[model samples]
Target: MTRREAGLTLVLMDRLRTQRLPRLQAMHARVTAGDCLDAHDLRYLCVSLEETQRMKSPSIDTREAIRAVLARLYHEITTQALSNEQARFRHAAH
Candidate 1:
C-alpha cells in the first residue's frame, strides 16, 4: 500500500515497523511491503532498539517507552510469524 511517508510515496517494509512516526515522516524510503528480514537487518534492529531505548527521555515512563518499542517490533515480527493454518499452508505450498 502506498503511503505519504517522509514526504514520499512509500510502500513500507513490514520488517521496519517504527514507533517514531515523526522520524519516519522525515526519512521513509519506498521498499517492498511485507519484506523479509536477514541476519544483518536483525542486528541493526537490535542495536537501534538499544540505542533508541537509551536515548529515550527520562521524563516519560521507561516501561511505556519500551512497550512502544516492543510493539513496533511485534508489528514487524508478526508480519512473518504465521498463524497455525497459514504456517502449514505455506509449508505445503513451498
Candidate 2:
C-alpha cells in the first residue's frame, strides 16, 4: 500500500478498534466466566492479543507506525477471510 493508503488503513483500524471495545469486553466477561471459545472466538481473541502486543511496543516514527499498522490490517483481512470461509464450510456441512 502507498503511504496514504497505509495512513488511511490506520485510521480505519483505529475506528474499528474503538467500535469493537464493547465486544471485547463481552468476550472478557465470557472468559472470566470460564466459558469455552469456539474457533471464530479463539481467532478473534488471538488477533486482539496480537494487536495489544503491537500497540505496547516502543514508539516509532510516523512512517514506521504506518507500516506496522498496514501489516496488521493485512493480517486481519486474511484472517477474517479465512474465518468466513470456514464458517461457510461448516454451515454447508450442516
CA lDDT of every candidate: 0.44, 0.56
In lDDT terms, how accurate is model 2?
0.56
The TM-score of predicted model 2 comes to 0.38
Query: Which pairs of residues have clashing backbones in candidate 2?
Result: none
Span of ten consecutive residues with least summed lDDT in model 1: 6-15
Per-model RMSD to reference? 12.0, 9.9
lDDT tens digits, residue span 1-94, model 2: 5677567657655854675455655654554454444689768756765554444212357546655664565455445556666776788899
Clashing pairs in 1: 6-25
TM-score attained by model 1: 0.38
- TM-score, each model? 0.38, 0.38
